[model samples]
Target: MASKLAHPLLHALRAGGPAFGAWLTLPGALSARTAAAASPHLAWLVVDCEHGMTALHPGAGESIAAVAALGPRAPSTIVRIPATGACADGSAGWQIKYALDQGARGVLVPMVSTGAQAKSVVAAARFPPQGVRGFGSPFTQHAWGADVTPGEYLAHANDAVLVLVQIETRDGVANLDEILAVDGLDGVFIGPYDLSLALGLPPPSPDPHPEAETVIQTILAKAHAAGKKWSVPLRLSFRSLPRPNPVTNCRDLLHRGTQAAKRAKEGFDMVNVTSDSGAMSDGIAR
Candidate 1:
């Protein structure tokens, strides 16, 4: 019942319940569809353009549509644009445009270190008066399955499109207060492994270093105190994992069930299916 007016992710967030998400790193529509269908608990799916095999332009767009075709209750598709903090300016605007115009429910901007950068992301993802994002996608309105006319989609999109910034850098931690104060931001998604590395600690091995865990909790508290949603994952990355037997790889979600429960207990807004595409790949069972 999330995003009753539009996207399910928004609906889930508004419902004040912890939404589960699938981490999509692989490309192709079939893969996305499979993932969306794997778990009824899946409230959203993130098309990982940042580090995944999925390309931004056609790939992410196709994935968005693939999941949308599953109907209104199907998981909402969000795009994690592949760019670093350096492109906080208008350079990232076009990428944001592509993702939203393709009918994505949300956009996750990576490595946002300053409030100005977070504002830039928010502005780029929204329409005018609130943002500089342009309109004209005939397909976008259909993606939400409401049969909303262009006018309806345009009117609600500014509020419906969730904009989140990753707080993973040293400067991001230092400026967390300022970033949280920025208007138009929907939430903050913590990148724990990167946060560890940024803070001169090792990447989390299933869990963050003790010090990094402290920081993660601090971030959770800060996000809640600021009245913004906090999103994170059980595992930070799967890029380092070897290409193992597909069946073995697919059991990650089951393996992480305990951590998932722990995350839910900690008041995270949403937690990932697994650290990688493996959890949902090849129609893996939840």
Candidate 2:
């Protein structure tokens, strides 16, 4: 399938407003419920390709395929590529290129701690002199058709690919200025869990740690000041269902959303909800 070319991330950037999104770490790739969680109104989709163990060895092709299938069906597809030396072995670059060429709207490089690391991520996602990324479109480029040209492919590949960096360690936050200064960095995503480890503190509610939130707000403020977009992950557990099997989990989420809406109707304003999974769920109001 010659995937549609509009990048949701670009739209998000253009909107220049707070963007809410979710992370999928459950078994299997993006399930129907996971995909359903994505709202076009939301800015992006961070497919936790690295830390989220939905797949033992996350395959770039499969990840791209799954996300692409949701195009126009969901928000932008931002695959969180492994941010380790293992990916530095050319295989990771291939994965980045394949995902992009296969219609992934963007790539999120996780655990980035330095300017060089951020640049390396850019290199993996781009092609030629600009970066070292390889090229292939497969079905995504043409949306499964064969009309897409090399020129068009290269242009779309360059113009629309979103590059995100995850700042998870204290080192990354301390060196935030240099990392954000790196050209072509699309955004700085915060990983609260690892960040806590970096801060020598327990995980969320990362409250009571004004220092950590300060660092996060600093990153966010700097990113905004630098004219960069910011993306955050939200994790939600619905109350409708007590247990979180795939089926009940979704129902519970809907039930909770419904209740929240009902509360709003009753004149109580409830904008966000926090749940387990330790991942950030934006608690998107349906």
Candidate 3:
């Protein structure tokens, strides 16, 4: 059934290839469209609403629309809403609702550290009977496609929309089993940067401490064991930190590509290859 959906990510996974994606942070319809059409290997694109310049309300919607405009070739849009880490609380409900309401194919909640927290995020992304998401967005069906009516979308959305949570804190890793047990959660996305910081280490400077790497592997194994997918963005976190040499940016992309391939072979379901700004930075530095 997932294969029948007009979702490129599903097609990519089915074809056993090009499961990687780019993260969008620049904020604009043009930026979103460019990233979506950037590569055929891109199976997904995350519209960063948390720390990115894109506003959660109008900006995320526009970006999702931009990707959807690509029709069949568009990578699936997954919005990372604001609220860095919701720990054991359910405070991210409204934010999840806003993103999903805007027609995002999925929602990635950051810093989820507990089973209860995971359940709440799932609830907010799903409709009642299974969860508590409201569905009155008239424009949402348009993003799905011209043939999809509101009724069809509402009927099939619960299955099509993915709800993934970022497991990047000590508590999240410790409670991994419980969080993975949450129903309606499609997968877990690992945030190497925050996970390192939460575990008493610096963010990955192209890679994590040996101990952090061990933990990441453990999480991946545990998620797969529980019959859930594991995902991750570029491992060279440090979005705000500077580099030793701008020239290293080119090598970094190569390193990232290598890492992404290794993980994908290791059973990682989704791996983000780069970002809008990351590519631009590498190009400018070269």
lDDT winner between 1 and 2, please give it: 1
Q: Tens digits of per-residue lDDT for model 3 on 1-286?
A: 4233467775665565447888888989999999888887788988999867899999999998888888856888989988866534657888888888888889998988889889989888888789888889888878777677888888888988888999988989889999999988888998888899999997787788899999989988898888777887784442445763565776777888888888788878888888888887777777
lDDT of each candidate versus the true structure: 0.83, 0.58, 0.83
- lDDT, model 3: 0.83
Ranking by TM-score: 3, 1, 2
Give me the runs in candidate 1 sitting further than 4 Å from their true place.
1-5, 236-255, 280-286
Error of 3 at 122 (Å): 0.8
Worst 10 residues of 3 by lDDT: 235-244
| TM-score (C-alpha, index-matched) for candidate 1 | 0.91
lDDT over C-alpha atoms for residue 279 of model 3 = 81
Per-residue lDDT of 169-214 in model 2, one digit per residue for the tens?
A: 8778888888888777777877766786789976543132577667
The number of clashing residue pairs in model 1 is 3
